[model samples]
Target: MNTPTFRNWQSVQSEVLRRIHAREWPPGELIPNEADLAIEFGCARSTVNRALRSLAESGLLDRRRKAGTRVAAQPVAKATIDIAVIRHEVEEHGAKYGYQLITRRIAVPPVSVSGTMKTRAQDKLLHVRALHLADDAAYAVEDRWINTAIVPDAAAEPFDVLSANEWLIEHAPYTHGDISFSAVQADQGDAEVLGVAPLSALFAIDRVTWDNAAAVTKVRLLFLPGYKLRTQL
Candidate 1:
């Protein structure tokens, strides 16, 4: 197996699949052992093991002890992500779609921000702040920081026509992202942006994306008071 350079397991898996499909690691080729992958990924051996095990169970690879793992001669599965457009999501609920770009800037990421991204202190980010509306009403305020080092073209885009969330779905292609959801009392800044009273309860969604070797973006979206998100598994 060829060693993958990605920092995250999800990205590693995606790259592994890509390489397999591209014949970089041809079918029946023994892949690099898990220890080598763990070192390359800068993660625990268990993490690499988990990703490889998943691939094996999906029939993309065949795993065996001592003999190690190899790409399956007949790969049996493929995965696809259905990225939904936020505008479509809102409109599906009978709400009109409106978007406003609040601010756009290129800045050195702050210490706190750098820590979250696992990036160096001097890294620059393409910062985008915007509001998403429903029927001309505030629906959400989004604060996003794009890692310019990972996706340099982000600095050249004109975001006035498309929200960062929408633009990223088209520009960035990653297998998965880390998402965290929480509820918090809106601060003055968040409240003003979302057109709600300070201290009002709101829902927050934070997401961080990664490619093989670097962090791609970090975003925090604050929903207006009374906005509810529902999903079924």
Candidate 2:
């Protein structure tokens, strides 16, 4: 049989994925090292490395610095949610998007927020509150805190023409973050901003992102009733 040659990292990745799915490399089995994979695939070592790194990110393969890469005995299926531009998201749905900045201040946040953000209680953060509108009707209320120490440019931003949600995404790109989705009863502040009854059930997403080890921003977005989120595993 002619030796199979791969041209790019994606082709190598596809072949590796095929081997995994076909059980040619079974679960918990240590796969060949990158140098060996490179020789076998007729590609550069970096191509194999890139392919393996992609699989590792997706929880399919486990790679240790010194330890040989191995197939995950149990691969975790992850649903990735990309940070979205709300204006684009609303316009895609055929509604005119509007934004209103409700509050912008530099202040000490709550103790819980400080703890999660890894900032001292006395450390003042930039807090901005805004409302997103769809066809002039309330869509979501965004309450956010930005670490000016990490992103100094945010301190000068008024968040009037732009929302903090969209601003931080463009400026401070985070390496990783935590996110949670829940059905929350609207508090008075959020209810007033979203124009919903206080205590009405709302879909809420609380997220905290960091640029490397330094905290970047923490935000909570409470959507009006009937908000639907869809993601794939």
- The Cα error of candidate 1 at residue 134, in Å, is 0.6
Residue-level lDDT tens digits of model 2 in 7-93: 999999999999998999999999999998899899999999999999999999999899899999997877777558778888989
Residue 199, model 2: lDDT of: 95
Model 2 misplaced stretches (Cα beyond 4 Å): 1-76
* Residue range with the least summed lDDT across 10 consecutive positions in model 2: 77-86
TM-score of each: 0.63, 0.70
Per residue, candidate 1 scores C-alpha lDDT tens digits across 57-164 of 788899989899999988766544333566887898899999999999988878888898888888778889998889998888989999877777788997897888
